[model samples]
Target: MDFKLTDEQVKLRKEFYDVCKDLEKRKPHGFAGLESIYDTDEGWEYHLYCAREYAKKGWISIGWPPEYGGKGTIGDKVFFAEARGYYDLPGIDIFGPEMLAPTLLGVGNEELNKRFLPGIASGEVQWCELWSEPNAGSDLASLTTSAVRKGNEYIINGQKIWSTGAHRAHWAFALVRTDPHAPKKQMGITFILFDMRTPGVTVKPLYYMDRAHVYNEVFLDDVHVPVENVVGQENEGWRVTQLLAGFERSSLGAIMMMLRQLEELVRYCNETKVGGKLLAHDPLIRNRLAQMACEIEALRCLGYRIADAQERNEMAGFEASGVHILASELQERLSWLGADILGPYGQVKRSRWSPFDGWYEKWYQQSFVLFIAMGTNEIQRNIISWYGLGLPRMK
Candidate 1:
């Protein structure tokens, strides 16, 4: 359980940082967050450009098997993520390499792997998750979206809500009901993938309060998907769903983003004077900043622990939930602190008067998304209690 990076890992870490730093310099002004890839034409092009750059280095498949274009270990993947987070770079699609690739490696058949892995590794295809339905978010097993087999294809008809970047995705991995007669709701479910451009598929914008089009409502009306697109086995998608969830929650990128923001805030406080005194000199500000630093460090350590577990091929299950809860809550706190530090200017966005290009303003408005996305913090707590603490589930 040594936390130190080996000499080679240290060199690889430096390489990641050096490349990301150069990329950061070329980033368009106002380029922030994954939503940028979907909200503006320039942003989307820039995202694709960065993706190609990383793909050329074989970085998108860093943690995959060598046959699939992968050449690095899981630890290398972690370092790359940290570098991207610290620099606020966006090239890797979280739905693709971060979640689906590993899941495919673990459960997909040879045909499925050979067909899809190459596209993802090459960064030639982007993906979205169509998991949540209007009435089936937290209780996803209750989803009623059906995919009935018809010859060699499954005819899909349903709706998916809160699908992030759906309008920009080339393909989507989704959960659907393939069997209505199964004894349990979870038993009837299936995991499948299909092209977004498939006939009968439609995507509509679901704008944020700030009018950002980062999410969408995706509709399927007899969308034809090849039966071969199914991941793992039909009528047992809940297990696949659970497996992907582990990767989703084990992300360390957000934590590194917070660290960068914290560093920026510290610099601002040290240089800016308020009431004829440095903000850093204010005891109250110092106390809050110090507290956030410590919390962020704790989360970083926890992330490393989870990554270590993953390297050992162990199920991080509840540990991933723990990281999710802490990281999301910490972000909320950090955003609030930023707003407080900036006062009224914090509320401004994309304006000359706003500080830090109003990044904090937008962040404060959207920080609550993580509380509900992927899964709710309340649900995460239940996972921690039930799995980590060995507590009984209340019937």
Candidate 2:
């Protein structure tokens, strides 16, 4: 496959990189320079304000179509890579514009697209995915959340766990069962978006081991939504969900965060010494670093390959699944390497003697959560086995 980017794509990517450079240069000092500065509500408020200002400056549309107030720039992988390389941005909630945009643009009604796409692309609105019900995770089609149609509205009632960023998001794109008697488990599902501020919608904070409120439990209690919010045909949401999950898995931007963490690991290893020598000088640590670098390069190429397939309108079924699985695993491994480099400090969360500005201190604590987010590695492997390899069901 050719590794060349077109002239226009190259130009747009360079422009994106330039903008990120400016954002990085102008970013606030203190805790803002950290990987995830917006862990707190107050910190997020400031981050959102920055995001809004960045949006107004047209700094938020690398993956959206032009008709939806975006630059309609293609070659999203190139643009995202350039942005991450230029700016130290932690890549939070990037799926909203990249993964969710494609799903909405492809299947959403004209009205729905027109109403939400612009705001979404502009960073005026934030969206969270309400997937992973208690009983249904990897087997997402087995979801039991119910959305019954009545007049021009659908009343939804269900509980969604591990809804990332729902506490800060303005809306949610969720899957619900609109048909109880559908022939197949996947047949009754529908994809819909609803306001998080609606009555009967309860948001319960779920704290991680590090005492960070990142994930949430969202309860929908007979919440009413306009029928227009539904994407594609009723009871066909499973297909849309499949496509969306593919987008999420295939996205190249997720690895950028890992890339940043890798840089931090190198710096920490070099600065922290053991046995009167730098940790980076150790053979085992050096080998681990070399392995991480190689894996990251491979993952980067895989991401670009997915993007190339997307540009050619090819279905990247198992490749995307494998990429997602590999990326998350590499992230966890890198975090473990960080903890190892820190030694006893690996387990510490808050202290005056932490290294890497206490970044690894936090990552060492929250590394497990990375494996389970979006979808677990087990789910990803199942997708590859069943969908990619055409494996037989166990039962």
Q: Of the candidates shown, which would achieve the greatest lDDT relative to the real structure?
A: 1
> What is the C-alpha lDDT profile of model 1 across 77-142, one tens digit per residue?
889999999988988888888788888998958888999999988888999999999999989999
List residue ranges in candidate 1 displaced over 4 A. Answer: 248-250
78, model 2: CA deviation in Å? Answer: 3.9
Residue-level lDDT for 376 in candidate 1: 98
lDDT of 1: 0.89
- Report the error of model 2 at residue 244, Å: 1.3
Best by TM-score: 1
Q: What is the C-alpha RMSD of each candidate to the true structure, in Å?
A: 1.2, 2.9
Instruction: Give each model's whole-structure lDDT.
Output: 0.89, 0.73
Model 2 Cα lDDT, one tens digit per residue, 1-395: 68887787677777767766665665554343222443565556555665675577565665556666666434654565546543555333555665677787878477888888777656778888897888987778899989999999999999999887788888889899999999998999998888899898999988776577777899999999999888888999988866765563323655766677778788877787788999888999899998898889888888777776766767556677788778777767887888787888776655576665566667655666656666787877877888888997565
Determine the C-alpha RMSD for candidate 2 after optimal superposition of all C-alphas. 2.9
- TM-score of predicted model 2? 0.88
Candidate 2 weakest ten by summed lDDT: 29-38
